[model samples]
Target chain A: MSNHELPRTEETRVKRLPEKQVFDRAALNALLDDAIVGHVAIVRDGKPLVLPVGIGRDGDTLLIHGSTGSGLFREIADGRPLTIAVTLLEGLVYARSAFESSMHYRSAVIQGSATLVEGEDKLTALGILTNHMMPGRWEEVRDTTKKELAATMVLRVPLDVVSVKISDKPVDEFEDDGDDRAIWAGILPLRTVAGAPIPSAMTPEGTPVSPSVIAQTIKLA
Target chain B: MSNHELPRTEETRVKRLPEKQVFDRAALNALLDDAIVGHVAIVRDGKPLVLPVGIGRDGDTLLIHGSTGSGLFREIADGRPLTIAVTLLEGLVYARSAFESSMHYRSAVIQGSATLVEGEDKLTALGILTNHMMPGRWEEVRDTTKKELAATMVLRVPLDVVSVKISDKPVDEFEDDGDDRAIWAGILPLRTVAGAPIPSAMTPEGTPVSPSVIAQTIKLA
Candidate 1:
């Protein structure tokens, strides 16, 4: 195994179609960096509740922060078992048969118990989250106040137990030897695009859009 | 309340910031219609598992289908509590303060028990799923055989206990009352864009792209 590859644990092993599983840490890092939102799963009242929250990665740890007033966050801060999933829909896979049709995606599921970061660590995690979503805005925005910090909960889940899956195989490979040569089988790639920035009404009449926002939109385009 | 408003039950009540909760059924329908994938939450061995699955709405019931070989689907088909969450991140809300920075999103969470659909209902549910992802292709693709249908599991979760949240509030309102008036605060709209279709290697050189695929690309653009 390469130096950056993540070790496969019992929980992280892909049981179904093991060929699709990816163990490279670089692949996992890229997936986490490209995604802005992740689904956080936790058991509440004997039922699983999946909540979408903004996510960020600080080195090897995945950080998730939410309002302390949220019931789900409060339950998650108790250091219970949780799973966070980030899935990017890359393309639509077209096939000759309905059964073989699927989506091309890269999904990373991290299962671990979260530990709440308090005091100064919480502030740093919040910074990481803000910077991940909108780069360079954290420096321009006002510093977080004591009251504001108290109102939030920042939890970190180490990338210890991770399962990554990338499904980009061509669907026509199954039909290359078959009788269906006329069928149109291929992929339609999809990606997130940023649109023009809309200044808020409260902003000064002549204030220009932030440099980071402009850069982001250009990168996306 | 309007007749189209969804009933607020104990399970569907928006506990955090009740004012942000939406009850309009039209809004709910629009969200489900626009989204192709949803994170389905279920408990396995006392831990919450969140799986992203293709979702489709057939009237009031939301259809979720997967391979029968999936262990998660097998557990869900046995009639257990499940929560399906669909979130669309519309824009990044930038504020003068880091604490107020957030994402504008439309999210709907439906909590209920799923029941397995068999025979004719399963085939119809599969059609709904396919049509939701790519309209008009279901008719063009090869018909689903009996063995193919048998290999898939279609589970229906009623939109009975649904909670919708739309966070479109302008974050600049906080800056207007605060001390930071020089900061640039605005929204960076985000959306998924479709790229040019790439035909499979086995496809004929002159074969045209499918009608549904062309329509989808145009719509996305």
Candidate 2:
């Protein structure tokens, strides 16, 4: 579904970017889907807190898991307003002048209130989150006990309020400042590359690398 | 040599981390000195904004560069509270339960008003910022023009309040869990690896790759 079709509220600002911005949702999703970790920002009693945490996406809803006791997750529920953004800076931007310098980034921001998914929804959400983190992991690993589920909190942020902003360009100066004398200015692409995956030491020696891990290499590429 | 020494100020919760936190003039300076980029968090009209910007360390002062026309930097020296934090996530903390999973991060949070610098300080700060991003190219690039400086803003955040919170354990849990399931859990280890550096086409032919690029391979290591 297109971004507009997702549930969006008035506070959603349709920020602008250069014309070169990408329009492909698949590419955007691929970037978000491949990573298992993200940085979450929230305001706690008037103070801003940013934490890196594990995250998962189930279709359109993003599942963020926290300790049942986390102050950040506890502060949300029902329909409180909040903002969660996940950004992967794909490349470094270099401009002749610092003013024009910008990053080639793919960032998805969700502005909405998250609600607790309970009962069967909670079970399914847990399954999805585990699978999102590792392919075949949910199936091979021990299932969560009832007590574990009761002690965990998962915040589900709907996808409709999400938007992606990107910027990528070669340096173009209004006039030549003779920077060719010493400086080399241009875009340098950056990307995450998977090295040899380390299996859990306790894992059986005969277990082959899962299909999910193999797929991510090309997915991020 | 700890974070406490950076010329900076304490947050309302200066007691949170305690001596485990650093708050010396030199501690803050060292933390800033070892790093090249700083994450500048500014409050614009009561909203918190975090941007990864170029920064330089000068004795006890931290320097950040931006455009004068940029509303964020323009408001920095206006006696508004701008929280400048520079952090490097050194390690990941894997816990038996996701709730206990945390990161070993070293961050410096300084609150204060910034003032514009002049004379040699400006030139020196600009030079450090330029070299911070790409080391060898600074001497090759033409110098900043007058109009550029007139349009640039540099805010100095003193290193007065800072600390390092770090956890590197594979899985910290209750004794029973650690003795049993903890054996099943271990860190996958996170590292950023630089792939083959693609040279810019503008680079003169036959110029081999520089050591600066070679050194980046282990940045995430």
Q: List iRMS for all predictions.
A: 1.7, 4.7
Show where candidate 1 strays beyond 4 Å: A1-3, A173-180, B1-3, B175-180
Instruction: List model 2 lDDT by residue over B127-207, tens digit each.
Output: 766655545444545567788777777767765444443334444455433334422333434434444544454555655
Which lDDT tens digits does candidate 1 get at residues A1-31? 2249887878899876679999999999999
TM-score on alpha carbons, each prediction = 0.95, 0.74
Instruction: Name the candidate that leads on lDDT.
Output: 1
State the displacement of the C-alpha of residue B99, model 2, in Å, after optimal TM-score superposition: 6.3
> Residue by residue across B175-209, what tens digits does model 1's lDDT show?
23467676678899999888988998878998899
Reference-based TM-score, model 1: 0.95
Candidate 1 docking: what grade? Answer: medium
What is residue B175's positional error in candidate 2, in angstroms? 8.8
Predicted candidate 2 versus true structure: per-residue lDDT over A1-221, tens digit per residue = 54524333444443334254444556557656865655555454454444445678887677887777665567765445655556665554455555455456666656566889888898788767766664434554445677888888888887665555565555555447563523444565666554454544443465555554454444445
List residue ranges in candidate 2 displaced over 4 A: A1-28, A44-47, A77-80, A94-102, A173-175, A179-185, A194-221, B1-62, B75-79, B82-119, B172-184, B210-212, B215-221
